[model samples]
Target: MNFIKSLDDKVWMTAKARYNASARLNKKHQALTFTISFLSVAQIVLTFCMLVDICFGFPEKVLMFIAMTTSVMILVIANQSALGSLLIESEKLHRFGIKFQSLYEEISLYIKLDKANKSVEEGFQQRYSQLLREADINHLKIDEELVKAERKSFELNPICALWIKFKNLVAIYLSSFLYLAIPLGLLWGASWLK
Candidate 1:
């Protein structure tokens, strides 16, 4: 028998996939929240040092002006990044992940009980949709892709898998790091000249 022929099976499958995706998304958000936050703090500290240098007449006039401007830009960008991915949003995503987990379990139970009727399926589907609406924001596409990957593990050729992993690495980790690293490197190099 095609397992998914039953409505409850379909609902349970979708809910389980969604829950897994949400969990991955939550992890991504938490990582972004922590990484961006740490980088912002480091930027602020670097900016403070630049200000100190300005006060002490440690840099040439032109360099001092550049440093001051750079400091302001750093502060502005840090504020923007913080606003873009607030800790509260990450916490909200975490809560949503739990909610998805609950929904998944509920559907599984319904399936186990052989209560796979149209009404039950529709109700659970509506609940899923409502939960998504309440979330107010959806998981990133990468999260969905990762969940699909888990379900279809080793199906892709080695080259394809490597490409996907590389893309994920760059998107999830390297991009954020480079955003801060480039500016920090410039500031650090500027410091060395002082």
Candidate 2:
């Protein structure tokens, strides 16, 4: 009886551990997703501010330059974060966690209700084998999803089509440098007009 109880405990522990890992991975990817989105929006706003500063000079040209440089940094970070998030496949991780939780519940119930014919240890092994098969399938699907996601580029909103075009035409770092220079060049040109 004690050995059977220990085996049951082991199955629960294993499932819980897997569920926790998946949940943690999902959270990390979710955070990266949020960060990338925030940075992208910030980059767009900064670009707009730079354009306005070019047309109508700001009170502090130095601050405007700083803002442009900062936007470039933000863009770089956003791209990298997006790439990382895509690699992690957060959605798949989240789905797997939920599914694993369901499996754990089912196994627990099975242990409780269906203990008539087989020994407790045998029943535990049967449920555990099913869990392992499901887990294997989940991992394969996630790997495929990750592959597809990694192949995709960092997509932006419709409003960011211009940035997408720019990215396609120029390398990211070079493009970021050009973005940094645009506001400064425009400011310099504006100053010359004065």
Candidate 3:
């Protein structure tokens, strides 16, 4: 009875520990997502402002040059943030995968032990059966939960990919817009000089 109870207690403890670890990983993932999102927004805003300045001729040649430089800086920052978020999320997933593998191995050992002692005392038999059932159920539940988590993590991947692509596109588009704006600005300024 005591042995059965100890086994049950250990199973519960392991499940609880895995649950807590997964929750912490999820929170970290959320923080990283938020950071990437915020940086993207800031980058978009800066790009828009720089485009507007180029279109309106607000600060002459010097102002346009400054605007272009600032936009490039924002693009660099956004790219770095996006890359960092991807790497961290991948690390979290790897850790969770390891935990799952370890849990599976431990459960398999317990199952094997239970099978080997099939001719034990009736009380031992009953306790073994009960422990096996509980362990199997708990493992299934954890696996299902992990599946949901993996799905969510997969969803975030494409979003991050799109964001990176969008940032690159914006950078290219704005750079070209500024390239054209520079010569046009010079021509307009030359006319003013005349």
Candidate 4:
């Protein structure tokens, strides 16, 4: 009974860790996607502005030149940032997190049922093997040093982490409004207002 309890505790902890890692990775993936989209849109908008200036004799040639150059640089950086399996790995981590959660729940159920007719070792081995296969399929290569550094930097302070996340959300929304929504609204000002 004690051994089963210990095993269950270990599995639960592992599952919780997986879920936390998944959330972190997914957040990174989302941030990268947003950054990529923002850079792409900025590039298009700046190009359009440049063309308009070329045709209409609108001033601000120097300013537009600077903006275009900056946009190009941003686009390049964003593209480079995406030159990885981040999205695929994030999705796989999410699936693995769910799997861990499910396994945890099953173990909890087994424990509550007094372990009758339930082979904890067998169940754990099966689920753990599945997780291994998933890791292989997803090519999940975790850098322990980086992970440890990140955890030490971010996860140590819950309040700060929450605040940072809130800030990121606000930045994403504000940038979206500024870069996409406002321009779109201006483009269809009359129709949209009506």
- Give per-model TM-scores: 0.60, 0.43, 0.32, 0.51
Per-candidate clashes, comma-separated: 0, 0, 0, 0
* Candidate 3 C-alpha lDDT tens digits along 64-182: 45445445544654564454553455455445445445554555566557653434434443644554454422322333333333444435466555564454344324433443344
Write the residue-wise lDDT of candidate 4 on 71-164 in tens digits.
6545554565452565666566667667766877777787788844446567675776677576643312232222333455335466655555
* Model 4 TM-score (2 dp): 0.51
lDDT of 1 by residue, 11-118 (tens): 444445455444544555555565557665654654576666643434555344544554555565467556446445555656676777687777767666775477
Top model by lDDT, which number? Answer: 1
Q: Please rank every candidate by TM-score, starting with the best.
A: 1, 4, 2, 3
In order, the Cα lDDT scores of the candidates are: 0.58, 0.51, 0.47, 0.54
How far is 124's C-alpha from truth in model 4 (Å)? Answer: 2.8
- Determine which window of 10 residues in candidate 4 has minimal summed lDDT: 139-148
Error of 1 at 42 (Å): 8.5
| Candidate 2 error regions (>4 Å) | 54-120, 137-194
Number of clashes in model 4? 0
Predict model 2's lDDT versus the native.
Answer: 0.51
Encode model 2's per-residue lDDT on 81-103: one tens digit a residue. 46465345544444555655565
Model 2 residue 123 lDDT?
58
Residue 155 in model 2: shift from native, Å?
46
